[model samples]
Target: MSEIWFRTGEATVFASEGQATDAMPEVVIGSVKGPVGTAFASMLGQTVGHTRMFILRDCNQQVRPAAIMTSKATITNSAYVGLLGGVVQAALADAIVDAVANGVIPKDIVNDIAMIVTVWLDPRTAKDENLDQKELYKNNYEAMTTALTRAMNQEPTIDELIANRKTIRHYSLEGLDIE
Candidate 1:
């Protein structure tokens, strides 16, 4: 209904719910005629241990915005493949559709916009039978929605970044001092 406000967006969200089942999604959204589209089309050729695939909400239904998903880790194990292509995939697709429904991703550009999501699904989850599939789903869903919202809004705006620059420590540097 309104003028298109977002031409390109990208963000990464890490959601922690399950150990080894923490979800991290790095998302890029843009027009099909842009670079995101080029990467989306070209990623189809990657068929190593892990391959790229479309994000589907169900057996025959892909999400409206038309998204592709790739793995951050090389998927060598069949079990890991199943988890990624199954639960994680569904989580992401649902998140995208809900984003549209909730106005995080505008409904007007569903056809023109394409999403490329690079997901990290921990390898440990595949080997651990006790790990809950629901937890995995919830984790990814939270991550996907948060990532999409952040990207679409161009979040961590200049002021937000400037204010929090010194307060937030890089996750990787948990214990080391500034010295």
Candidate 2:
């Protein structure tokens, strides 16, 4: 039974010592934001849909969570997201009739997708259960204001937000909301 393992380069692994145990890199898992999923889905829809439109076969799938985690860290590209969101919105606008007619997406699936996308865009709408009136109103107001602002102002891009954002003397250092 060997207690240590040597490497060609200067790196060595010792089984008896705890160095090898702690040598493994720490992997922090995170979620993916922005329109990566939408893009992936669109591509999948085009390619996979052509081959297996609605087959019930279980295909082996491998997802890279690390890739998703890294992408989520820097997914502040609102312009890219807006592009994908526009596509999703456009598809959703007529998905019901068109998908059903074309047999691309099922009606039930379309409805579910609409609900999911609606939830992703405005989470408040997805809450079916009742809550405190004040909190409910707050969430509703936030969601409505966000939607209205985006619609009226053309959904400011992340670059625009970064460029336009300015800090007040007192608020800037304190990280407080100026407006």
Candidate 3:
């Protein structure tokens, strides 16, 4: 006769070698005619050595899939800085493209303006710790106004505009977080 093992909860079931099913007491219940009964009956003939089956009865029961944890590789400072540079460049390019497309800036000087802006606002440069979007936009607007005025009065090189760019800083009347 085939051996049968029953388990419940988190308990372990131990069975002796060459165990017979006749040693266990018969368990009888009313006919189970639902999907669960069908699945259980189908599983009885297919179970092999040390097979495990879970039957969840409670509607509130939750089963979480097991996960294997792995260690992530370390990144060097130079590599991290490189990634930041790429991100900054992409953001600057996108902003320049949007500005030109929206007619905020002239299309003819977009590349030159982009270059000057990139040099002036390098991500590697030190910035105020508390600077936020409003402060950054304000500073940029001020810088652009100054550059445009200079260009209108007298033609200044890109280097001059870069040198005349405004510094970004946080300024608020009431104490509050910007983000």
Candidate 4:
């Protein structure tokens, strides 16, 4: 089966394969159900080979679908099973979109997602509270490369540059032309 690593809080839709019908019936969030366990059985029923789904739970008052994992048999020519997994994943992602759009899921889930993205993009900040106490800095790959190139200016002497240099964590655009 195809391995779909979906964004958090997103759901996908899946349809049956090779039914040879006009209207393909779609099942949304077949991986995880609101009432719980219903989606599990449905996914198992849909699996042509082997599949596994994961449900992340918060002790009380919160039990939602977190992640889904599906596997295909090694000895079987089950390439179509990958297509099936993709369908299911898409349905799950759509379900997430619908839930968020309809406000079925709490508003904080959006904020949680944003926070997660922020943490991933800025791991240095996320690592420690004190880390942000210094002058806050965010450097992208291009920006960092530009800064390095500028730092290595055509100096008269390496010793002179070394003597004048300061060990600074942050980058500045002011000193690039100084030779």
lDDT tens string, model 1, 1-179?
22333344443444354457788888888877777777778887777876688999888999978899989898878899899999999999999999999999889888887888889888788888688888789888988888888888887688998898899877888898872
Q: Kindly give the stretch of ten consecutive residues in candidate 2 with the minimal lDDT sum.
A: 3-12
Ranking by lDDT: 1, 4, 3, 2
TM-score of 4: 0.26
lDDT of 3 by residue, 35-133 (tens): 323334554442232121221112332111100111011223443333223332233333334434655445553222111121123232223243243
lDDT of each: 0.82, 0.26, 0.28, 0.29
Clash total of candidate 1: 0
**Candidates 1 and 3, the one with greater TM-score:** 1
What does candidate 4's lDDT look like per residue over 43-127, in tens digits?
Answer: 4343443444332122231223333334323213333333323332343334334444556444344322210100002222223
- From the highest TM-score down, the ranking of the candidates is 1, 4, 3, 2
The residue pairs in collision within model 2 are none
- Model 2 clash tally, residue pairs: 0
The CA lDDT at 175 in model 2 is 62
Top TM-score: which candidate number?
1
Which scores better on TM-score, 3 or 4? Answer: 4
The TM-score of candidate 1 is 0.90
lDDT of 2 by residue, 92-176 (tens): 2232233245453333332222111221222221232432333323332333223323422344566876776773243335765
